[model samples]
Target: MGVIEDLADALARDVLEAQAELGDDRFYEKMSKVLGELSPTTQEAFMTSVRVRLAEKRGRDFLARMLAAKRSGGAAPQAPRGPDSGH
Candidate 1:
């Protein structure tokens, strides 16, 4: 990755950790606002990193739930729907 991507990724990781530790779900928004004052490109990259990481985490959690339900002979969990999902 390029310098911007690397820096954005690192910032994303830190923001996520801080959000969890501080129980501040809006941390990403706040960080984005701060980044906006710096550079649009950097802010975009950081938001992209944050979105990808969050999506992957949600997917993993959904998978775990599905597996657990299957092991217990329960109905498989429904797939998660994102905001863009028509249903």
Candidate 2:
């Protein structure tokens, strides 16, 4: 991966770890507050980057699970990494 891809992967991994630690409710709460404070364009860009990074690192299935967990306010399952945390 290029430097930007590597950075995006790192960011996705961090977000996954953090969401697991915080559980869905708190994670969504924090994200909603932060996103609400951002401008619409910034929010769109941020969410797009986040989704792309997550989909790249963990696959569409994982991204779906993450979104489902967030919507349901439940804990997210651990990332399905094979080795090196799939980074």
Candidate 3:
């Protein structure tokens, strides 16, 4: 895989591991809070990236929960990869 792919894989693995340790509810929260804070266009990119990451992590419910959280509040923490967050 290329650099971007590797980064995605690594991040996905980390998310997966974190989710396994933290459970779906918490994991979803962290992811949602983190990504949702971005600008609309960035939110789209982040969501897309997150979907790819979650696909690698096999966190299907996590993704659903994030979407739900996008409408509501689910505790998704801002990951360092985001914009305006020194990511």
Every candidate's lDDT = 0.93, 0.60, 0.57
Clashes of 3: 9
lDDT of 1 by residue, 50-74 (tens): 9999989988999999999989999
Ten residues in sequence with the least summed lDDT for candidate 2: 24-33
What TM-score does candidate 3 reach?
A: 0.34
Off by over 4 Å in 3: 1-13, 53-87
Best by lDDT: 1
TM-score of each candidate structure, all chains considered together? 0.89, 0.39, 0.34
List, residue by residue over 1-87, the lDDT tens digit for candidate 2.
Answer: 655555444644466568877766236335535755855444444455567755675677788898999999999978756676655
User: For this target, which candidate reaches the highest TM-score against the unseen true structure?
Assistant: 1
Runs of candidate 2 with Cα error greater than 4 angstroms are: 1-14, 25-33, 60-87
RMSD of each: 1.7, 13.3, 13.8
Candidate 3 collision pairs: 29-75, 29-76, 30-76, 30-77, 32-76, 33-76, 34-76, 34-77, 34-78
